[model samples]
Target: MKILLPVDGSECALRAVDHLIAHAAWYREVPEIHLLHVHPPIPIGRVQAHVGEDTLKAYYLEESQASLLAAQQKLDAAGRFHTTHIHVGQPAEIIAKMAKDLGCDLIVMGTHGRGAVAGLVMGSVANRLLHSAPCPVMLVR
Candidate 1:
């Protein structure tokens, strides 16, 4: 099975990795894990101001890479077969798109993320993926 694991370097997100590691043998075969980190979009106004477009883009890439690295470390420690991706967009949208694009059978992610009021207002990544994902979704709380 192919499993898409969306993470934001949050403890809650890492919990999903922990859950997968603890339950690896439940699946009939060793699953291929896709670890995804979606970076927040750069502000358009800032891109036109003090920060050049290239610089802002570089910043986003760098941040996303860092997040991916952290996630890789966790997955590595767990001895799982996985690949990392860094995307720039809304987390929920990017996650859903990536899962569809990659033809993943399922998504394993955290229910609560880093956002405060926004997460509560618009719903968390897990909630959005649960309602919108094309495949099955497993939320780790």
Candidate 2:
């Protein structure tokens, strides 16, 4: 099975990674794992023109790397083989799309564990992915 793990550098997100690593043996075989970090688009319209494409790309790389670092280290320490990807867009949409494109069997991610009202007001990506992901989504708190 293929699993898509999304990391956002939050402790909650790391918890999700830990949960996956802990339960990895539940699968029949060691699953193929893919780590994804989605950078939200900068709202500045003309900022790209001022910053240049290369600079923006570098920013994305730097931020994504920071967000992915701990998760990567955890997987590495667990001796779990995996691949990493970085993208810019809405997190939920990007995550769901990546799962479909990679033909992943499951998507594992972390949740902030907000109350129902807060989740609705804040627009939880976990909640959104639950509805839109092509594959099953497992949320760890």
Candidate 3:
């Protein structure tokens, strides 16, 4: 089984990683893990106009690397093998697409666990993923 784990370097996100590591032995064999970090695109107005394409790319790379670091360290400590991917886009859309493109059997992620009103006001990527992701989505709070 292949599992796509989307992380944003939040404490909530790391909980998802921990949840996966804790439950890994339940599977028939170790699952193939894909660690994905999506960076929100810089607005097209001033930031893009001011920064070179290569510089923007580097910025995204740097941010994604920072966001992925803790998750990677935890996985490494657990002796879990995973491949990392970085992208720049809306998180929910990027995550769903990556899960499908990678042919993932499941998506594991963490949620802020907001109430419906708060979620509606703030927007919930986990909720969006639950509805849009091609595979089953497991959310860790």
TM-score quality measure for candidate 1? 0.89
lDDT of 2 by residue, 45-116 (tens): 889668988888899999889999999999999999999999999888999999999999999888752223
TM-scores for all predictions: 0.89, 0.92, 0.92
C-alpha displacement of 18 in model 3, angstroms?
A: 0.5
Arrange candidates by TM-score, descending.
3, 2, 1
RMSD of each: 2.0, 2.9, 2.9
Off by over 4 Å in 2: 113-123
Task: Predict model 2's lDDT versus the native.
Answer: 0.88
Residue 5 miss distance in model 1 (angstroms): 0.5
Error of 1 at 27 (Å): 1.2
Error of 3 at 75 (Å): 0.4
